[model samples]
Target chain A: MHEASAATAPGRGGRDLAISVRDLVVGFGDTLVVRGLDLDVYRGEVLGFVGGSGTGKSVLTRTILGLERKRSGRIEVFGEDLDKASAADHARIERRMGVMFQQGALFSNLTVKQNIQVPMREHLRLSPRFADELAMLKLALVGLDLDAADKLPAQLSGGMIKRAALARALALDPELVFLDEPTSGLDPIGAADFDELIATLQKTLGLTVFMVTHDLDSIYAICDRVAALAEGKVIAAGPISTLLASDHPWVHAYFHGTRARRFQDVQ
Target chain B: MEIPDGPTFKSSRSRDAITFELAGRWTIGASAALEDGARAVFAEASKVRRAVLDLGAVAALDTAGAWLIDKTRRELAAAGVEARLERVRPEYGILLEEAHYRQFEAPSGKRRLYAAVLLADIGESVVSFGKDVLAGVSFLGEVVASLLGTIIAPLRFRAISLVFHIEQIGFRSVPIIGLINFLVGCIVAQQGIFQLQRFGASTFAVDLIGILVLRELGVLLTSIMIAGRSGSAVTAEIGSMKMREEIDALKVMGLRPVEVLIVPRILALVISLPLLTFIADMAALFGGLLVAWGYGGINPAAFMARLQSAIGENTFLVGIIKAPFMALVIGIIASMEGLAVAGSAESLGRRVTASVVKSIFMVIVLDGFFAVFFAGIRY
Candidate 1:
């Protein structure tokens, strides 16, 4: 495990960090959701966030994306302070980051091809034919055939929907990708396959993946480091093995439990 | 603080009736104070049948201050006393003319009648007719598209899903529509009986109930009920879906919310409404038949014969024709209100209420327009 950590050392040393969140805090009305959390996602490393329900993992991701305003914080994505960023700056940052939501979140009425072409249409100056070809490429990259591109979201099964959404997310060849609950609601075999896909894509594209998930198998299989959130704070963060070895009861229970043990056996 | 120089008035009969000059920025509150002062000054001037206010020295008097003096003068005139204004400022005089202050000088009885008629017309035409026509046309277009989309979709799975929505919106809605239609039939029959009995024409109550329920009340009542029930549900469903990011998901993937979700729901309602209204008409007639046989001592067979004679096929058709239009309005308005919902659960609640109230109000108003149109036709 330590050797694995050393082998995945931060990434290209001279390149800047992809995302930096320092002493971040977020609240909904009177209740604080995320509190004084710090994290650094270096360029070209898949950083995973894992926690129990209501641990503010999703809220932290939303804050970093500028979708949710932080109460007090500094969030610099590619050296830009997203906290105080203008709409144009936010647009610039968004152009560089791709997001795949849970449930695939595909539009029910549009064909998968149109869905994949959305970012390309918005951020790139490609002709319709060129955009169609690019969408086909993305669909193929996600292991989907071109026939799947013309189908609506409602036509696809759960696994296919997730893959279609991923194809759309990668439409812009984004530097950073945020995956929220990527393996949620999938059967174990399906989830494992998706984890493999994410790992394969990360390596081939040299993309940084910042994923928020509770799926332990996904964390173990794909993530270079795990950030565990609890009670609005980061209780543990670093290599997955370091988190598993921590004295914290939640950490021990999370990484050495029945689910984790089964996942390790599969690996 | 020295007051800016303006109008001055003096009552010759009273030493205490001291009127000060008026000048710049005399807004509503300042005018109110001036009126209070004038009223106080007049309290001691009972013997003085007339008083004159001179405005030659006034630079400007705001609209409210001018209105105050106008009102005071009218009150004095109503008591068979006289008050006059002399040398009023041109700008203030123009303001008074625009507000129609001179109308206060008219004979009280005539003014009262005119005001009553005008108020009634505004209530009927602007508030009722204008809002209904606008809401109805837009809703009609939306409902038609929605219903057609749902009914004609190629996918069997989607069509099956729509069956559940139909059962929820259509079949479950029948009981409420039936109950309301029955009550409406009984009320109309009862009212007809009371009015006709004065002329020993009680049996004609059957004819009236037959025509009213089959030709109008049944459709109107069903539409109102469904608009309240189904329209509000659509608004809340879409509004919550919007808040939950479901609608945003469609937009992110370049899908139109209207073409996808709204069209289907609207279509379902449009197709369901006429059918529901037909059921309501039958239910209402059943209620009327019970009333005729039990309370009015008319045989059920005899009542049916008279009802059939009085309500022609054209009458029934007219009511049925109005059903789809009413349904269209309800669906579109509800969906529009839902899509318009903002950031909170409270917005969902507000939009639901607005959808229901607006749909019901528009349905009744459109019913009146159809009535007028049919009545005006020479055929």
Candidate 2:
């Protein structure tokens, strides 16, 4: 419902934002990777975050997840300021969100079903039977067969690994999910199917999806909106059409680039 | 749904048709009663031609309840009884459908291995052991070549990383090594005193502690401790780097992983082992001195004089001389295991454990060889 450019004032749109980052500066030692960056992800929208390699897209996502410390900034999630929240409130906020890391970050020691059950067991108390059943349900929900439930992450193919990780992300039935390069390793068909799956899941569950990706097909096919990052700042944010018309140099080159041409207007 | 106090079932028979009415909670909290009731009803229901299970009165349902219903239906079907479950709420229907989809298979029996399989495993292990030995020899050659190169061009050495590793494996480990050696010294003196007192030679405990601490225990214990503590850490660090492809990344950047990472760590261990052994030796002697005087009634002067006579320069030199070789064994074994790590957490753990075990085993064997060689030369 809310559509705005990257330079637009924060909280100006009518619809609520799931994640709001302002003046976020993250650095390691003397080098600044993300400086004075601002990002907004509106509720129930799949926001595809695009950037060149080593442009700090993963760093920014990690900062939002509280994995990396920010030099200076304020981050808000679900209407609560992250910096000022108490420990309990922080945990509550964390419980409402799920993350599927790029490598799937699956617990190698656990079976796929057990991995899905981890979030369920950590945040809720239920009988082991019910937990296992729910884990199977989640596995099925992610389009994995029942046999995949008993297999370890090491035993899965790349696409299966992504699906299993997605299943684990949806285990707790969170309102928000963060996916990093979810389809990077998959084949074209697998990647397209995955994008379709994510779109369906987002629409059905009313999830606020924050996806960091490099796949042009993914941005064009499923993302309700796209934000472009360059030189430690978000230079553009809008729908695919808006990004195509942008005059910024990096945005122009990225969207109209040779590799991106095939995917442009495919949606 | 609130769980009923207990699950109970009532059954009625009308000639060929049998109806079993299930009531109360069938969730996990009342699982025992639910199982019993289901078993009792199903056992008799199988005798009937037509069996119907009514669940309309059930107050609560979970995976456990669905499992019970599923199991009963399965058992009845197995008995050739035409059974039907009715009055299921749609909310609970999904639970039942999911339960039906997830029917757990019985675990397969334990693996039964044939003689060929056993023999193949042994052969594989022997071949792997041979490969490990070859790899170790080659790795040592590479390290020595790198060391020689650094010696020829001293600026090529990574002094900062070397210092960091030295501080990690040596300086930070002093307190623990000192305490363990000191305690070993005290225990040896106490036991020697207790045994020698029978022969009225309680003061001879000084000679026992002196010879053992100076000649064997000091270097051996220090080597063992380092193998367990720093050896495992080295393997884990390098193994993790290998697992994450950082070593490959270094190779891509036109750097040899051995020269950058392995050389600094091994050099640190080799250089610091003797220094650590010296500290352990001193702490052990001090501890023995205290126990000798306090427990054996040997005055400090007498104990010191006896210590000087009981062990000669060669005794001290024998332990100190073995420190570098022991350090080399630990460093080489640890780094070799780390480099051999595959891409898995399990592999890293296995490699680390093997590094410690193999280094300690080889160190003790090397010590035995040293003992024999030293005796041959009468050192």
Candidate 3:
């Protein structure tokens, strides 16, 4: 795992940082959800965000994607400040990034095949045959068969839905991927398998992953760095080992507390 | 006088004229027993001219019980036997009266005018059909090709998935339509009663209910309801999908959200709204019947008879004609609102509300136009 992490690091690979977020604050109405959060995502690195519920991990991610309005912030993706980017520039940035929602959020009415093909059809000028081939490739990458592609989201199991959503996220061959609770609700084995898949994909595709999750197992297995958030603040941020050994009460409780101890025991 | 207790038989030697002495609350728990009792009564009344239903001991009856009785009566009538209420309890009598038992009568000439309004709905349908055809031709193979490409390329599947999004936006929105139709029926009956009673033409309530329900209220109400319910649902569903990065995913993979998601929902809503309106019309009429029998002292039979006499075949045809046009308005409004949905849940809610209100308002306005246009015509 260490060797795999070293191989994908931006400096080692001679690639530039993929995302740089500085002093980002997001609020809803008059209430702030994300306050003064700063983070950096290097190319091909899996950056995991661990926080209690309502700490604005999702809000921060959405702000980066321009889906949520930022009260104040500087978010640069591929060296472009997305906050001030034009509609066309935003679209260009979006073309290079893919997102997988926590719920899988698969289009309920669409069949799996259609769901996989949606991105390809939207951004590219590909022919029908070419699009089908692209969709099939992505499905295969997620270890899903062509038969699964024809089934609707309602028909797929929870695990399969997540896999399908992953297939969709990878459909654009994005340089950066945002996954909100990618291993959430999955059993330990499924989550482990997902972790392995993410690790393998990150190495093979050289994709930068920004994941928000509370799953300690995922952080240990796939994440190169971890960021802890609490009460609308980044309480700690650094390499997983560094944050785990930190003296901060919240960090210690989150990373070395009873829950973490239990997670460690599972391995 | 205390009626002598007789033996309860599934099939008796005498003509089938037996009643279950329901002493407790009449609820769904007795459904099986009620079915058995109805079957027994039907079998025994084979040679009888009329079957008497005694409900004096029935303490309470709900919609299920009422439906059971209605079903039993219909079955008895099918066998050329009349079913009469004998010693009906006050509550059951009220329930029966509420169901329009006293308002059954043939329709009148005013009902024909209502039918003409329904016929006018067809004009709107033709316009929608043209729009759908145009949309279909414009998008055509591009949608199919985009979906196909997702199967082959590593990152192209996002585009392909968008083609099927239209079904979510359009096809599964019937519940909203049904709900709106039910409410519209209640409001129309309530308002109609108020207007008719002012002129001391209370009996004409039957004629008004029939004509309005069959021709004007049924079609008009249904169209407006669909516009609000399905239209708003469609808009919100698509808009939220857009906000969730799902639309962007498709675009990044080179798929047209308009061709893939918007078109199919538009088509589905356009096709489904008219059919939904037909169902809505029936529901509204049923609602009117309930209101009429409950407050207007009209029996279901006389009410139906007056409805038949007052509402000619043309009124029904006219109502049907309006359905497609109503469908078009709903489809267009919903799709437009959906496309306009910004990337947020709040936007989804706002757009959905706007879509429903706008579509219903437009449908009502269009209904007025049809009324005036038909009023001026010789037909």
Candidate 4:
């Protein structure tokens, strides 16, 4: 419990922070979705971001990725202040980061192979032979067959879309990855397989993963640290054990509720 | 942390044996350097009988890094040099094993070009055209069966659906259709007057406008306009519904989507096209009359007398007779395209385009056939 008292101050990791957001105020129209929020995502750890529906879990993630505007805030990725970054600096920071949107968001007209090559073509100048082989290597890393490369996104099943999206996100070998609701629509077995895959990738690639999720099983399975967002702010940020020990009414209730029995089963 | 430098290697050789020590990021960002280094390794390893790739000093590794290293190793082995990896981190080892060197053969669909290819293309287009006709006929049979079933069990007929679609397809189309027909009528009358006046037969322009407006142009224009507007709308709606599996959802619930979706729309078209054609005819005649009085110096009464004498009752009936068939062609084509929608937004767009273009072409073709039939019967 004492560890959470100053948790919002960020960075028990000190100089190793992958993402540091301070006093972030994000809103749409008159309604403030994320108000006065502060959070930290340290390097080389899987941070699971959880919030109730419409609580702006996605908004905050999008804000950090610069996909959404913030009314007032300071955001830093890999020690480069987002607001202060020059265009070139921003591109530099962006090239090392990847995002897998909630829906696959693959180009509807492109085959999966072309979809994977889009970012590679943008940022790297590789011979087409090397590019093709690299794309196949990525496809295999995410457990997709090379045959699926010629198919369009519409031809893929829901679970395959997730995997393909993940493959595209990893196309650049990004050090930091944002995954939004990675296991929401997947069946239980599929979700478990996905959780294991994420765990393996995070470990082997040394990737810093920031996942926004409502899947309790995913939270229990792979998240190295869990951040609970409520009231337009992060109420608690720590490991699963630390969150379970907190006495805040919502945090206590959410982690110990009937649904949390699954957490119990996980333990 | 500072950006790591590109991959570099230190190699040592002693009598038929060589060790290449690799270092640096070896990530995709350093791909160019990695390629040069791999080339350097291959050039050195070919002269030796045995080769070893040591990765103990590498700072970072990704699939691309692993792949490049594995490629060099395979290139050496293929050149008859015994090669293997050494001191690789377990994670890099797994990455290497996963992205092991393999050849991806391009599909063998490329055939040599020939004049026969042109003939083949023509044959394919003809076959596809035949398939489209067959598909349309089958779709027509299904709708007819549903229409008959509804007729036999009148209690199950969807009257409200028919009326609702009539409003969407016909009532909403009136303003644009009327305005365009009026403008077209004015243009045709002005052109007729200009051409005929040079021949000292300017008053004959009145008869031309009367017969053309009453018999052919009015209904054809109305049908073409509707095909672009409401026909496209119907195809888009049904195509999107099919994309989302809503059509299949209705079938699983034991409801015939053809009865619920296609029949009412087609019936509404059948009921609405003639009424719209009548509107188009009157609007165009009014426009032609105004032009005749203003531009051709024909008084209102003179123009009215000439128009009444030039157009017969059969002339009006002949134009209205084509309306229902035009409606059927548009409805059948639009509905068939909608049902054929596969699971993509691009497919929906393509189906809507095909619906509009095919229906308009078929409308013109059907009108030509009717013209030939009426001429044969001397109607």
lDDT by candidate, in order shown: 0.74, 0.87, 0.69, 0.89
Point out the worst 10-residue segment of candidate 4 chain B by lDDT.
Answer: B104-113
Residue-by-residue lDDT tens digits, candidate 3, B65-146: 4444655677778888877666776656554443321212221335557667777778777887588556534443444454
The regions of model 2 sitting more than 4 angstroms off are A1-40, A51-96, A124-133, A140-147, A155-159, A185-190, A204-206, A229-235, A248-250, A256-267, B1-202, B237-241, B244-283, B286-304, B317-325, B365-379
B1-379, model 2: which lDDT tens digit per residue?
1244677778999999899888887754453465577678888898899999998988766555676787788878878898888898885676676445345542354666798789999999999989988998999999999989899999989999999999999999899999999999999999999999999998889989988998899999999999999999999999999999999999999988999999999999999999999999999989988988898888889999998889899889999999999999999999999998988889999999999999999999999999999999989
The collision pairs in model 2 are none
lDDT of 4 by residue, B43-128 (tens): 99999899999999998888788888899989889999999999988988877876687887664667868988999999999999
Instruction: State TM-scores per candidate.
Output: 0.47, 0.66, 0.44, 0.91
Q: Higher-TM-score candidate among 3 and 4?
A: 4
User: Can you give the lDDT of residue B241 in candidate 1?
Assistant: 91
In the order shown, the chain A TM-scores of the predictions are: 0.91, 0.95, 0.91, 0.95
Name model 3 segments beyond 4 Å from true.
Answer: A1-15, A262-267, B1-379
Quality class of the docking in candidate 1, CAPRI style: incorrect
Superior candidate under lDDT, 3 versus 4: 4
Off by over 4 Å in 4: A1-5, A9-11, A247-254, B9-23, B49-59, B82-94, B103-125
Interface RMSD of 1: 32.3
| Interface DockQ of each model | 0.01, 0.07, 0.01, 0.57
**Candidate 2 C-alpha error for residue A88, in Å:** 7.0
